[model samples]
Target: MSGITENTKTSGEPSKENPSPNSSDTPDDEKKDDRMFECNICLDTAKDAVVSMCGHLFCWPCLHQWLETRPNRQVCPVCKASISKEKVVPLYGRGSTKQEDPREKVPPRPAGQRTEPEPGSAFPGFGFADNGFHMSFGIGAFPFGFFTSTFNFGEARPTPAARGTQQHMEEQFLSKIFLWMAILFVAWLLLA
Candidate 1:
């Protein structure tokens, strides 16, 4: 009876000294590994890849379509960080040359945004003078005139207005006006 019990225990449990053939650590096993550079949206190897600020990788087409789908809320699909067409960085790789040209699509991948470095403190000529002020005004004919604006700033650029102030009230009014204009424009497009 004791011998029978011992035999059952040995059969039921695996031996520690000898590992199973199915173990993943075995170097002799040939398994196909999926590439790490897969698109978050399409689940395929990323082509014309772009990396989000949050560091998730995706194919540019997939990300662009996603952004177009929800133009109002442009956020990263993986991390939900605030992202926009201007924010994504395009990846250029040796293999990218072999991929199909991305320009054939309706909306091509967004161009990377580049800004010139700010003038250093030593370069005083480029900066605003102590009492010097700057203002710019442009008057485009008719329809484009609404888009144009005149900006005036003193020695220091004007800061944003605090809530509940007259300046804030004016800003809110202008925002609503623009919002209504945009809605009207869309409605006109649909009718046309």
Candidate 2:
């Protein structure tokens, strides 16, 4: 890629009004080499470069800002292909320093994800036992069992408490509460 100093004036400010004399004078091969690494968004040499699945290149910071601009609609800035933070691949070129950490910037590019291979089928000896001795219980008698336990069906019901006792009054209050609750539930069911 073309170095930043190649386009800068002696004062260090980038030349906007006049094209750099050396830029046109440079060989076409060098220009093509420079363009290959230039970010599609900023149109400059890509720093912290990343490539979209659509094969477009961009600076990580520029691409991140583009994604932030329309979070609901993440697309490639160049090809408009479906793109996301996880899908972009970071470009690590030769001479890039390993000591320089990418996360120093906000919202670092996602690291490449690797998946483990699928496990093979179970072993032959690991199969279920072959004794042919299996025992199973059925719920076909569940309703009868539940009623027998709860209401003691076919047996005598408990006798009621004598009138005016505290236990009798509490039982009466509970019965009234239950009756009102059942009535309200039935009314709700019908209305609904």
Candidate 3:
């Protein structure tokens, strides 16, 4: 990737124009060396590159999207942090996410409002409040196990948002787990 000089006459930073070496429409072995590294997130030829705190470099969009709601995606593709929601360094290569700390930027924690854990969070075999195992299923696929103090297994219902969307499909997958539990429960009842 071309380094953006301290000078700013060109676009006040790096050139915004995409790289287009007019040497050839046909692939040239020599031009390959001139190719700028593309950012993984945006897939654009990078004029500068920024490394994530995880040491991963991606275009602004990819890293930003990853950071925006990273609870859904916990692992860093590069470093594999169990908790990657916290991006340490703002990569400066290409046009990655501008240097900004999520913690500082995160809105004030709501009063008495609990932050929900990711749908299925775990530490290998162990689990956390966000861990997916503490919860179980009913008839249909749905997520009953969330970080909540009030988890009632006696009833079968869906959360308002979990009522639909891809999450519902995941909950349905858990329904099979529920079905097996139901069978086991019935057998235990008869034995008793």
Candidate 4:
């Protein structure tokens, strides 16, 4: 990656445009290099540069401010591609020195994320092999056993959601529907 200058003029700061360098004086390679690293948002050399997943360059500060200005819709300034602060990849140029303290209010550019590789098992065993002993006690009497198992006697169950919440209302509605269905099933069984 090409080096970006840290002390370069920010978009917010005043700057004078240099007269176009004579084609004969400046090499074609140098001219291309200068324009290549410019931030899409600030239209200047990128400082604390980051590249969007869509491959557009930006100064982290400029991009952060742009995102802040329009919180609802965040997209690439160049391509209008979907973007977010967390998803942008920071560029670390060679010989770039870290500043001791940040002078600007904008937070530091996001770091690259790394994840560990999944472990490989030599032999995949049946899932139940490691669970050890299993035991169950059942009352042989038909009516009592059905009640005990169906009601999950002495087993912990999740408490209902708070009364006024949408989740609670949905649960109550579903419960009533299931209760009616069960009653209809019992009635059908007796008639048949």
Question: Which has the greatest TM-score?
Answer: 2
Largest lDDT belongs to which candidate? 2
Candidate 3, position 19, lDDT: 40
Model 2, 32: alpha-carbon shift in Å?
1.6
**Superior by TM-score: candidate 1 or candidate 4:** 4
If scored against the real structure, what TM-score would every candidate get? 0.38, 0.43, 0.30, 0.41
- RMSD (Cα, Å) for all candidates, in order, is 19.8, 19.4, 17.8, 16.9
lDDT of 1 by residue, 30-120 (tens): 2311234578899997777777777777788899889989987999998799997777766655534554544335385457667766544
Against the hidden true structure, what lDDT does model 2 obtain?
0.61
- The runs of at least 3 residues in candidate 2 whose Cα sits more than 4 Å from the true structure, single-residue gaps closed, are 1-26, 99-104, 108-192
- Candidate 1 residue spans exceeding 4 A from truth: 1-33, 98-192
Give model 2's TM-score versus the native structure: 0.43
What are the per-residue Cα lDDT tens digits for candidate 2 across 60-110? 889889999998799987778999887777766555777353433647545
Full ranking by lDDT: 2, 4, 1, 3
Error of 2 at 60 (Å): 0.3
lDDT of 3 by residue, 1-192 (tens): 243421211222232333433433556633442343455566665333444554454544455556666656666555676434344343332344564533333443224536655544233333333323334434332234322323542332333234558876677677667768867865775698
